[model samples]
Target: MHIEVAKKSLQKNNQEVYNFLIDIKNFEILMPENIDKFEVLDANTFKFALSGMPEIILRLKEQHPYEKIVLGAASDKLPFTLTVNIIATSENESEVGLSFEGEFNAMMAMMIKSPITNFMETLSKNMDKIA
Candidate 1:
């Protein structure tokens, strides 16, 4: 499954947003208000549980300086990647977007499509918090 959230402009520059996202702990600020549990396991990993979702562990999979950050699920049972793309629009402003790609069977994909799409959109909307 692949899902892309709408991009949003941030008040901060691309480098600032990139720096904030590089630290896994900063993700807490971007999480929805319904988040029930959250913990930074290390510099590049975190565990979190939403109101009705199972606990998920995510680890940093790749980074491209101020351009992008990719995070992958820690377990193969639900393998997925969430990519954060940053584009500098000016000296002190930028736009950010979230894209999710997952490996799931057709039946499972149908079951998760809505919730996953909502989750990605929520995260993208929360991108402005980085400022």
Candidate 2:
């Protein structure tokens, strides 16, 4: 099975959001329970640990500060690609639209979708605070 999620977040300062993306390490502080570890391996590469799982490798396939960021992940349990696009609507406004696509067995797919959706909602809600 495959799953996808798209969310629109309230706009905020573009530079602030861009800086937030660059400071990858701060993910743990923003979403402590869901994100175990976020390491910037290089300018466009990193490794991360998700909830209840081992560290997964992720490479920033594409990134445009304050505009968009796309990440790909490969895992036995769920091999998926997540694309996050951030667009600045105004100096103090921006929106983040996330698109997820991938494959998984039916049972696992059903189990994972709910949590993933919840996670996205929570993340979007907290963007203002973090920004």
Candidate 3:
């Protein structure tokens, strides 16, 4: 499955966005159903455990200190790669764009899509709040 989302935020620039990303890694908060745990591995990397599910490993592929951050996830059921790029439009305006693509078996695809979609939506909302 593939999903893309773009949103505008009031954040100043890439630096602010990068800081927000770091905060996201540390925050224990969850979106919908509440994630079981979130662990920060290092700058730009983390591991996540979703509620009622095994841990999903996430690795940072590329990052530009808020300008853009790309992440890849590998798991038992659905393995996906996603890139999130944040662009500064002005001193106090920015936009976030996300692109996700992955291959999923038929059975897992159906079950995972909805939740992942929901997660993305929640993520967008969270980013908006920070912005």
Candidate 4:
């Protein structure tokens, strides 16, 4: 399953957004308001529990400098990849997008598709407003 969330112009530079995201502390603003718990286990790993979803660990898979950030589920139980792409549009602004790539069984995909798509879209919109 592949989900394209949102793409929009961000107020900050590509490098600035990239740097802020590398630190999990800033991720709170990008998550849903009802998230039960979010903890940073390490510099590149964090675990979060959504209101009605199982807790999952997301780890930084790779960094493509100021262009992109790739994160994936640390547990094989829920295999998925979250990609953040940044393309500079001006000196202090950039076009940013969030996408999810996952492999899910037929029934599972049917269940999660809408909720996850909405979740990622919300995250992407909020991320654009970050300074």
Candidate 5:
């Protein structure tokens, strides 16, 4: 399944957003309020846990300068990819979009579709504040 979240216009330029995201620690600023634990393993890896969810680790898979950042779960158990794309709408502004890609069975997809969509929307909406 693939989900496209809302696109947000950021006050920061594409390079600013790219610089912030390339550093894993900055991700904490966009985390949910009920985080249980957070850890930065390195520049490219970080792990966090929500109130009742298991800790999930994410790693920077690939980054294309100021254009996009590709990330994926560090563990094979959680097979998913997240791509953050930045479009420079103007010299001082940028449009940000996030896409989540995962393979899920029918039952699982049905169960998670709504929540994941909401999460993605919230995440994209929140990025501007942190950028």
Candidate 6:
């Protein structure tokens, strides 16, 4: 399944936004306020847990300089990929968007769809924090 959250225009340029995202430490600011726990394990990995969800470990999967960043779940139990795409609109402005793609059985997808979509949207909305 794939879900695309709302894109947001930011005052910061794509390079600025990309720089912020490349640092794992900044991910905590993009999580929902109800996040249970957040930990940056290394330069390219982080783990976070939401209220009642299992802790999720995400590792940097790929980066396209100032264009995009992709993180993949470390566990196959809930396989998913989270992508942040940055599009430069001007020298000092850009748009940011988040997309989530997951592989799950029908029953599991049905159960987690709403929460996952909400999570992605919240993350997208929080992109302004980088500005």
Best by lDDT: 6
**lDDT at 14 for candidate 1?**
92
Over 1-131, each residue of candidate 4 has an lDDT whose tens digit, in order, gives 99996587887999999998887767877888889999989989999889988888899998999999999999898799999999999999898888899999999999999988988887887885575
Better of 2 and 6 by TM-score: 6
Cα-lDDT of candidate 6: 0.92
lDDT for model 4, on a 0 to 1 scale? 0.88
**Which 10 consecutive positions of candidate 1 have the poorest summed lDDT?**
122-131
lDDT of 2: 0.66
Candidates' RMSD to native:
0.9, 3.1, 2.9, 1.1, 1.4, 0.9
lDDT of 1 by residue, 19-109 (tens): 9999999899988888999999988999999998889899999999999999999999999999999999999999998999999999999
lDDT of 6 by residue, 1-131 (tens): 99898899999999999999999889999999989999999899999999989889999999999999999998887889999999999999999989999999999999988999999988888888984
The TM-scores, one per candidate, come to 0.96, 0.70, 0.77, 0.94, 0.92, 0.96
lDDT of 3 by residue, 11-129 (tens): 66767876776554633343444787778877656788778767777777766786777778745356688777788888877887767788988888888778777777677666655
Look at candidate 6 and tell me the lDDT of residue 72.
98
- Candidate 2 structure, TM-score to reference: 0.70
- List the pairs of residues colliding in candidate 6: none
Cα error, candidate 2, residue 129 (Å): 3.5
lDDT of 2 at 102: 71
- Per-residue lDDT tens digits of candidate 2, residues 6-81? 5555656666776776665545454546677778777656777777867777666666877776777744455777
How many steric overlaps are in each model, in order?
A: 0, 3, 0, 0, 0, 0
lDDT of model 3 at position 12? 61
What lDDT score belongs to each candidate, Candidate 1 first?
A: 0.92, 0.66, 0.70, 0.88, 0.86, 0.92
lDDT of 4 at 29: 74
Query: lDDT at 29 for candidate 2?
Result: 51
